[model samples]
Target: MYDPKIFKTYDIRGIYPDQLDEDVAYKVGRAVVEFLKADTLILGRDMRLSGEKLSGALAQGIVDGGADVIDIGMVSTPLVYFAIADYGHEGGIMVSASHNPPKYNGFKICRERAIPISGETGLLEIKHLVEKGKFEKKPSGQLIRTDVLDDYVNKILSLIDKKRWKDAKRLKIVADFGNGMGAKTLSNIFNTLGVKMLAIYSEPDGSFPNHEPNPLKEENLKTLKKLVLKEKADFGVALDGDADRVGFVDEKGETVTGDIITALLSKEILKDNPGAKIIYDLRSSWATAEEIQKAGGIPIEYKVGHALIKEKMRKEGAVFAGELSMHFYFRDFYGVENSDLAILKIAELVLAEKKPLSELGRPIKRYFHAEEINFEIEDKEGKIKEIEEKYGALQNAKVSHLDGLKVEFSDWWFSLRASNTEPLLRLTLEAKTKELMEEKKKEMISLIQG
Candidate 1:
């Protein structure tokens, strides 16, 4: 039987060979082509050892389904998206598990113009087709090998202000690639922009020789923080395995949350395009929305997930959108997350301001946020309902059921959402004061745990 769990909300991912292997990968490829009714398909993979085999199997299935394939080997997730949109291909596939461990790999499929095919989109259709296991064999389609690295770089550079970058004071920056795909793309971007870069673990090692590529966890950022401090760099940035999202460290080596990055970038983007709508996920700190409005940009809140955010950006004609998970989306990027742009924008912000990142970020750092806490529970949905019911009774409390149960009071707010994949409930609480944040966190955790 096909492993249903591998078909997640965002992509198809699981342990290699056991839950996901060559056979499944091939079927997914065929199913994607069949579902999209496409003639040409683009494909790429990360540096994982299994990527090559899985991508090859996928290509075989695509060819068997009589679809021409443009195979760009060993690329980041964003690059795959770039290729599809750049070449005007009908669809594309990226074999990557993103920040997941090396043993896990998956496929991120996109439709025409590089639009994401999530569970709510066309992912379920592909899953059903693959499970049926009946594919007509047509004459095999030809495979073409091409590289879009130069094109991708040129496109991004065109969006940046070369004169401003050249005129700004040279700043030293540190980056930890986590031995993922960032080393390949970020190095080239930085080198072209002529920034002093002290790179760590920049090599593309699927083994994740240093730490896991996920910078959301504070522990994963320890080494980057140390390097930034020891080197006394202007600031630092870290990218996940596939380089679609990024994390930041200030000059003082303090990890900057994604919401702060969102606020900062929103201010920058709005300076150029005032009144443009800026989208942030619901879980983001209130400061994100406040800062966006302060910058004269319309702040719009949406549910989390790249697919959802991208759709919202397109629908709202948003200038930029950010997720708490470090994914930053741009309208210029065909409504997809591109951390490369995010890194450049941050560098420009620091260089132009002539202040440390922490100092620049201080104005928007106006809240106390209890970082996301996850609890494994059997009755995840019931627990969320219970938390909502408990908190919903509070006077002047507002509850929003967008992606989860978010109860907002005058001074504090908390959100409880059931995990889409795991049997877990996640909580995020924020307040006007640290004491209040702690008090609300404790009060909510008790309800969730019980």
Candidate 2:
């Protein structure tokens, strides 16, 4: 039996054995085969404890449904995406709970060319098919094992110019994988690039011995921050469970927010592809858009989510897209999110600038931002409307309900949205001054919760 709650806006995710088990995995396997009408598929899993069992059961179901499987064992999520496109498979599935606790596990599924299956785009249908469970029986298809590690590394490495390699070698970097699957590919990339790297929690451990794999949380980034300072490294990098999302700590051991990194990288990319369109989620800091425009690139704000961002990237012919949640997508990468590419782009930028990461980001860190805060509110929609009505009357204020209620003023903006997973209302506010941000935050909180 599968829990309906696991069918999220973008992927399938839930606690293992209880909410998600081999039975559910098998059903999802069959559902994907039928829903995508796939003849062949690529499959991979992270270092979670239940990965083997889940992938085994899922593969059995897929093969039983008469679709061949190219099993690329024990890889990061992006590697699975790479395998699907690189090998010309019809679709793929990755068994990873992505930044969740070790006891939890789930799958990220995609059709040909790494197109995601989400709630509005086939995830619900797959869920319905699984619930129905009346699958057609057919002769099992082949399950072949393949290795994509070297090819994946080489392909990403090719994106970097050889001249930058020498400068990269001069840099001392530190990486904290949080005992996830990042070390598998990252170690290879570092070695091949001849860069000096201090790897922390580099070993793949499903138990997450050091800390949680999530780097977005300040607590999770503490270790990386310390190591970067202690080693005096050029910068520090952190990746989530499947290594698709990345986080950074500057040489000063300061944790950089996702949008700041976006602004920095936008400057680098825009230098090469001038006037290119870049996508930033509405929740991101105004610095992202300001930096993009200053760098001669067109900035477009889109609703958040990997599926939506990728769709916008393709539609606008955007060179890149960055979200406050740490997801970065690239047009060159078949419109897929790739933390590895973000790393390389940072490396190139560092080489070109010849400045410390912290110094490089100072200009873009002009604005004060309130970290995303959530309030447990029963009337989510009504509260959002109330705040909208109160603020919408302000002169020169712009309101957008794209993904939530966002009000923009000359010096500040705030977004209020209902959480998709819980009975909570989320708020994020930013301003030109810390005092303004504090004042508005207090006002917003009182209005939202009171």
Candidate 3:
């Protein structure tokens, strides 16, 4: 019997072959086909050792449910989304673990517009179908292989003006693929752009021999930072396991957060399309919204989750949206998020003007943010209720429960929410000064721990 708990708030992920196996994947394929009534679907996978087997099994189920499959084998999450949108397919699925440890793997599914499938949207139905185990078997459908690497590369290149790439002087960049699927697609794209690239861990190794693929962890980005400074490269780029999320290091070896990158890109994008709508997750710094407003664009704040953001983007016709976790979305690019495409735009902005990244980031104001703190506590619901009653009466703060408990004050704000996957409370706070942020963080921690 399949468990519905594995169907999470964001995407389907768990310990592979145990919590999620080929049987579960097969059922999920059938559910998706039935739900979307998709006649044609696109499929792709990451570099995880189990991805190949899972993709095959899932494809079997998708075909068995009477849908034709376009297998764009061994690609990233964004690339899978790209193939779905570029080829005008009805839907797509990516077999990936996406920054999780080796024991984990799962799928990211999307309908047209590359819209994500989440629990509140359609993941619950998919889970219910799997648990019911009552799928009507149909005749085996056909599977076709279409290597869309060239088409994908061309589409990305088309986003940037050809004159920019042709007239660019010799530039050096250090790209750290981290043994993920980024190497599979980025190599050809970079070569076509004539970039002098120093690539590391470009091989597709699911074991992740060099370092874990998550660049958000400070330890994972050490090698990339060193390479950037050692080579005096123009910049450094890092991609998560599935390559949908990106991390960047400046020429000076300083790590740049996604908020800062989004701020930079917002200026460029708004220059072309004034008064366009831009979206950012609540976890991001206020500077993102301020920058968007300063650029004459409307800024919409949404809860943290790609599915929610994409839905909001489609409704508002947002030109661009970014998350603090390095996911960047675009309305023009079939409304699907793509880190690879974001990288290309950043490269163009850098080369268009001969300014270093640190200089480019100078305009945006910075703040001290406490790392997201998680606590395993009993009475998840009761504790939140108590905290809300205690702090809900504060005169200087405005509290809201969008995703979790968010309290906004004049110069600072903090949010405490329960983790969907665990018995834990996640706290995120930001303030004008490090001392203030530290004091606020300690006070909140005491209240929750008490």
Model 2 per-residue lDDT tens digits across residues 1-450: 568888888899999998989999999999999999989999999999999999999999999999999999999988998999877888999999998889999999999999888898899999999999999988899999999999999888876677766766788889989888888788898888888989989888999988999988899888788888888899999999999999988899998889998998899888779999999988899889999999999999988789889888878999999988888887777789888889888877888889889899998889999999999988899999899899998899999999889999999999999876556788999999999999999999988877
Which is the winner by lDDT between candidate 2 and candidate 3? 2
Candidate 3 lDDT by residue in tens digits, 1-116:
25566787877888877788899889888988988889988999998998888899889989999999889899888788888877788998999879988878888989885778
lDDT of 1 by residue, 1-450 (tens): 257789999889899988889999889988988999989999999999799999999999999999999999898888999999978999999999999988898999999889999999989899999989899988899899999899999998888878668644378989988888977777787788777899998889899988999989899999899999999999989999999989999999998999999999999899899999999988999999999999999999988788889889889999999989999999998889999999999988887777889999998888899999999888777777777777788789898999988889889888788877666788888999999999878877777776
Worst 10 residues of 1 by lDDT: 161-170
Worst lDDT 10-window in candidate 2: 159-168
Candidate lDDT scores, in order, read 0.89, 0.90, 0.85
Alpha-carbon RMSD, each predicted model? 1.1, 1.1, 1.8
Candidate 2 ranges beyond 4 A from true positions: none
Residue 61 lDDT in candidate 3 = 87
Error of 2 at 164 (Å): 2.0
